[model samples]
Target: MPRSILSWSDRSLAAQFALAGGVVMVLSMLLIGRVVAARIEESVVRNSALATSQYMDSIISPLSQDIAEADTLPPGARRALDEIFTNTPLGERVASFKLWKPGGLVVEATDKTIVGRRFEVTDSLARAFAGEVRAEFQNLSDEEDRGEHALGLPLLEIYSPVREVWSGEVIGVAEFYEVATGLERDLAEATRNSWISVALVFVAIGGVLFLIVLRGSRTIDRQRAALTRQLGELEALSTRNTALRERVQQAAARASAANDRALRRIGADLHDGPAQLLSFAALRLDALRGQLAETGEIDAVERAVKDAIREVRGISKGLGHPDIEDRGPCEIVTGVAETHEARTGTKVAVICDLPEGLALSQAEKLCLYRFAQEGLNNAWRYGGGRGQEIRLDCRDGRLGLWVRDAGPGFPPEDAERHEAEDYSGIGLAGLRDRVESLGGSLTAGNRADGAGAEIGMELDLRGA
Candidate 1:
């Protein structure tokens, strides 16, 4: 109901239960104790009244036989009542006595003023006339009880039926007040005991429930703490994994760049050293051809030298890296195709469907160039450069490149073996590594239409 109470209750499961259950237990105990005390007091008063009424009935029933026919008790009966009250031990215990005819008429009473008086018929008096005994303790509210009230002590007021001796029919009612100091003391003791027992039982139950709640609350708290610790550990591990992955990707990019630089150096070395030596040998052989008598050997030697120079130059040209850093994805791919066509004298079909202003990282650009270069070279060498097609496009934020040829595809078994082979040159396997370094993948297989073989590479632009 209040913020402070709610906050306190939320402190723990046990506290919550204690706050709510304690209130219920206390209210229940009070209600049950009050009811038990009331029942005990009522039982004690009724029993005391029954005993007093029975003893008085024994003495008065015989004297009051004339009351069955007459409205008032005769003088003789009245005198007996006076004698019993004045001279007997019963008078010491009883505070006052009265005899009533039906319809609220008091025919006789120890107090002479209330005799022959008519008062309102009370519930107890009516019950007594109907042949039942009713009793109340210390209740002096009736007009007839004014004298008893003046006595100023606890009194058990009793209304008992008087029956005709022969017929057992109720004819008159006897109402009396008995001094009940002992009963009052007994009721007080009983009420005290009842309240104590109820309180003790409720407390015990509350304590047991609290213990259960406390045990469960402790268990849950432990589990929650453990789970929190575990979650923290998992989060830390995840962060470490993310950092490691980024490091790996950076290493791969650096490696790819280093490999490209090495290839360019090797191409430069071949072109500057071996091509010059082979060209000089060819020129010297041509000069010596005229001096030889049998010119066939000289011609063969010169042709061989020329072929060696041509091959070395071609290899150097293929190995040399192109200046593609400033170009977009479409221009890079188209340039590679055009270069391949000019070198091999073969026409290449170039399909560029990339979005305008497409961008890529340096690593990705290098990977794409090498992929197209290697793919077209393979087509020329293995497939006679027939029906060569380079397809490029950007789809769903990923850049795709495909080089296809109208030649027999790789055999399934050889293709699988080739994927696992170590590639030292700028071949399919090495190209695969370069692509994968930029978070891209390369796949070599037959075209879906069965018209050619296709080598495809895809890179995620977002990751780049």
Candidate 2:
């Protein structure tokens, strides 16, 4: 009927340990009590048998002589037996007695009617005839033992062998029934005392162990709570790191967009302010030359003003980007390549192998345009102004731009040094930043043929 310890809901470690310890302690105590009681009973029975056998042997020698031949003992021996049995220290403790011959015949007894009766040889009687003394606490419930049963009390039955003095042969068996009230009371008390002592020892040991377990349980609980708190903190920190990374990406995109806007503004300013003013100055110089017809200084000034106007206009045109938001990938690439070819007056081979109507965001389009523009310019200035190849392709969910020129490639060491110095001139580094801000990657190296410099940019367009 006991509940299982594991079945307990939300039970603490200390409680579980106590429950298990208590169960083991109780089981151990039960086994100890059984063993102690058995040993006590054995000792008590041996002592009782030895005492009863000695007292009966001394007084029953005469009765045994006449027991087999006669139904009753001789009167003289009978009177002596009667006097000893009723009026002695042995008689006070012994409740009843019986004498048996070899064939289960009751030859003489304290109960007169049973003197001539024959009963079956019991296990105890058989053992006695075989020269053994047997003693046990018995209930006296057998039919042959009805006389003793009538006493209505517990008895210690001792079966003693009556042997011949000279031959050392067992002649008859004597059954002695002793009142067991005092013995039972003593045994019960001893058992109670033993159980109490053992239980106290077990409980004391269990108590000490439980206290140690309880203390350890408290420490474990505290550690568990602390670890849970630390785990929560780590999760929160991870979430914050993710948010911070997202914010950094957003900021980089905004910065790239700001740079493009500034370039357009600077280009507009150059064209509207500096280029217009220079053109007006060139026109006035021409007019002064017309008025001072043969002045050589006037002619040099007019030509200088005209050259300045052209240079300023070229600078403005180079800085501005064509609006290409509504255009697809091919149109955007073609526009950038053509503008570069026109301004530099160099041959640029354009190759476009993209899916029809490839959609790109406005920022992504600007990034590609800037990449192509910078790459071609670098190729012209540093790549011997030779054959240049501009390629735009979208395949396998990626958009790519590759620019190559048949010129000496940029050395890896030189590239590393430039990057460390944060080089931005000629717009190679700036182009890389704009592409990267749009979640793209750019690489510059020699072409696979090892004959020319190459700049390549790739963007993941799966999200788009």
Candidate 3:
């Protein structure tokens, strides 16, 4: 389809409708004008034929046989013919006339030079000879008829058969050229009236159609505008949502880093204040036992003091992250994976693709270590630990840590079970909070290969 000048996108509905209506109106006017003009011309020719035929009969019926075929009229009859045509009121109405024989000869005419002249039989002449009257408005394109148009006036050409009054036999044909000035006026008036009527009807119909289309167009335009406005609002909302999500992730990351720092401080305080005191007490108990070998409670006191020191040391180890701030990211990730493997007996495969001397903040390194530690521990405990792999990759200013295990995967069917279990799902949630707080994301699910489960974390470290 061709594109519209007033396309739907570019123009309002009302304008489009108006343009279409205008085209239809113009086409209708042209069609109606042609029909009206054709009808008016036909009516004028038909009426002129009837009027001219009757008048010719009054003059020619009296001598139909006197001028039969090829100017065979006697001297007196010819004189009578000339007198009736030239010296009467009817003569003023007629421009010319001819009596034609069946053999295509002009039997008699007002132009005496044409008398007995043979002319080609025209369709109208042939029809008249066949006992039918024919009439037309002529431009005189015919060679024989051209001389008659020298007056520069339109003519009503009529062909009427001169019939016998008694037997109704068509004996000859009479061709009449009547002055069409008055007929032309009547036709003009009729044509003007028809055009006016058509125009009025066109206006009334087009107006009604335009009004209906305009209303619908306006409704459509309103809907489109409202939709556009709604779309704009939705786009703005989406942008804000993205910004809020980023801010939320950053806040979560900062919170996790703060929490880690607090725990590290607590661990240091416990080790320095409580663990040191326990160790000193254990040493004092050893001396007291030697001093009081007779007392039975010395061994019990020594064992209790040693046990308290051990527990304090264990608590401190659990609270602290790691002392690998000066190390590269690769060293930090590998250390966490190795440590987890040693503690859990779950052999982890570590793949490091980090660039050498990559700079990162302490919190970022801690976040990476924590993620690796949590991911490896979860894989061992929950994944059945058939096979384990840890991957650390840095590319395009983003760091990714992935831990996967070839064990029972996390499936949708096990979701409720995991949620109900304290250690199963809760640990992952804490890990997520920690990762998110550091402006990163964490995800845990079945591996793409369907053979294991995978837990991954991604952090943006462009400014690290």
- What is the per-residue lDDT of model 2 for residues 1-464, given as tens digits with 9 covering 90 to 100? 34653466457789889877789889999999889877888898879788878878877864676654555667787777778779888788888888888888887678988788888888878988999888878657667888888878889988888876766788788888888888888878878887888889888989999999999999998998999999999999989986776577668888878876786788789889988998888778877776875879977887887888887777677677777878887888788788777877998899999887677878888787777777787788788668898999988999999988998777766642122111123366777777776668888777887888888889988844
lDDT of 3 by residue, 305-356 (tens): 8888887876677678768769888888788777776766778888989887
Error in Å for residue 54 of model 1 = 1.2
Q: Which residue runs does candidate 1 get wrong by more than 4 Å?
A: 235-464
Candidate 3 residue spans exceeding 4 A from truth: 1-20, 54-84, 98-134, 160-174, 209-249, 260-376, 387-404, 410-413, 416-426, 431-450, 454-464
What would the per-residue lDDT of candidate 1 be over residues 166-275, giving only the tens digit for each residue?
A: 99999898888888889889989999998998899889989999999999989988998999999999999989987887688789999888877886787788889999
In the predicted model 2, the residue pairs found to clash are none
- Model number with the top lDDT: 1
Worst-scoring 10-residue span by lDDT in model 1: 415-424
Positional deviation of residue 162's Cα in model 1 after best superposition, in angstroms: 0.5
lDDT of 3 at 30: 81
Candidate 1 accuracy as TM-score:
0.54
Each candidate's root-mean-square deviation in Å?
A: 9.1, 10.8, 7.6
- The Cα error of candidate 3 at residue 326, in Å, is 14
